[model samples]
Target: MPLSAGPHVVVLVEGRSDAAAVAVLLRAHGLDGEGRVKVVSMEGVTNVARDLRKSRDEHPDAMVLGLYDVAEERFVLGALRRAGVPLEAPVDLVDHGFFVCDSDLEDELIRAVGTAVVEDALDEMGHLERFRTFQYQPEWRHRSLTDQLHRFAGSGSGRKVALAERLAVRLDATTTPPPLAGLLGRIAQHLHP
Candidate 1:
């Protein structure tokens, strides 16, 4: 598949939750990512590398970005590399990407949504005790409960937005991704200009 001269940045994730977080981030960043950043998530890591490889082959010239957890980063990146993905190239076969966190897209959501709202939301959802457990679990201990709640909320766009809106009700300015605006624009900048 030859690269096309269009504006589309496909974002492959590990699950629907990750897709939702990226979707909201795109909205918050004023990037319309819903359309451009196509979220093709799998049930587990086994199919991630495979799916990415297939997408890359299908869109050889397009900028296909894969975002997932750091735990599987090494494996995914290695898979892409083995599939002839040129990480250093300006517009290579695939834009190999990943994030570091206990949960894949949770950290980003926590960072974006803040703490108080998260705690309240989790309390509303009746997960306060489990949330506290996550807080004391060493790795999750350092991060604020609110942020952890944001990550949990970000499991899906419907859930994430509902949580955001609820939080917004309490405070204000809980900005979210406006579908596929900024992400498409950014991809355009990278591919075109």
Candidate 2:
């Protein structure tokens, strides 16, 4: 469908977890993301090219940004190229508003907030005991705390998004993961400028 007239920003994310994380972080940063910014889950990074094309056609005047795993840089760069966004190299991604999570959004959040903060969020959600149990599982026993937490966050149904939102809620805007924070900053700046 056609976009409504005037300014809007579209934040394309890889999945529900990223979508939930972005929306929560924007609010945490005191932005009404739901107002002029829309967080869309593209389902998979490979589909970025298609979605970019569609968003361009449908919202020709809207600013488009995205968050992707660092591992998916090639796909994002290719998508941008296909969608007619000129880029000299991968480093220009942010100049065009895209941000890269360290490995993935979950990993970024886990590292940004640190072990204790993440544990506290898990505890607040009543999942700390379950997480402890997960760590003791045979395959997870030898993993690092970060690895265990990352995997545990995605292990259960709806758990990934739930954990993402919880982690974002627990984070102060100043301490937000850079990629997520950058996305919010770009959105706010674009909307106001």
Candidate 3:
């Protein structure tokens, strides 16, 4: 679909899951971004530079912010640098309108709500038993619960996006994970301040 027009800020996320999570959180916090803010998932972390450049080229006056996984911080930093957003490190990039997820959005959400709660969420989705079965496999037996959960969430196609949407909907606004909260706050500040 073609992007909406006029003075809208663009929030470049790594994928649809992040986009959905961000969208839900923004609405939860009372920020109506349907037309004023564009949450575009670049499809992958590797596309950060290209996406940023494209957004800038298409919407020169629109403010741009980025959300990425911590593991891809270097790529984000390089993208920001190439886009002329001055920064020396991941933390520095935040002030330049880029936020890094700890490990990834799934990791952040899992940590924010805790594994038990996530399991409860999975149970609600009728996948908790399946997840448990996956967890008991020899290869996953020694992994941390969080790691196992993360892996399970991504193992099936569309699972990550579904979980992200459901989890974001389930999250309490006041207790949102730092990276998400910070990204929303930055978007709010940019749009309202």
Per-candidate clashes, comma-separated: 17, 0, 0
- In angstroms, give how far residue 66 of model 1 lies from its true place: 2.0
lDDT agreement with native, every candidate? 0.55, 0.85, 0.84
**Candidates 1 and 3 compared by TM-score, better number:** 3
Tens-digit lDDT track of model 1 for 32-83 = 5335445566656668668777777666655666655657766666677677
Candidate 2 — which pairs collide?
none
Give lDDT tens digits, candidate 3, residues 1-193.
3434664688999999899889888888777545777789999989989999998998887889888888898898788778776564325777788888888999999988888888988888889989989999999999999999999998888888888988898788666888888888887876677
Candidate 3 scores a C-alpha RMSD against the true structure in Å of: 3.4
Please list the residue runs of candidate 2 whose C-alpha ends up more than 4 Å from where it truly belongs after superposition. 1-7
Question: Could you give the candidate ranking by lDDT, starting with the highest?
Answer: 2, 3, 1
- Flag the better candidate by lDDT, 1 or 2: 2
Could you tell me how far off, in angstroms, the CA of residue 43 lies in candidate 3 after the best superposition? Answer: 1.5
- Local error of candidate 3 at residue 117 (angstroms): 1.2
Which candidate number would show the highest TM-score if scored against the true structure? 2
**For model 2, the run of ten residues with the poorest summed lDDT:** 27-36
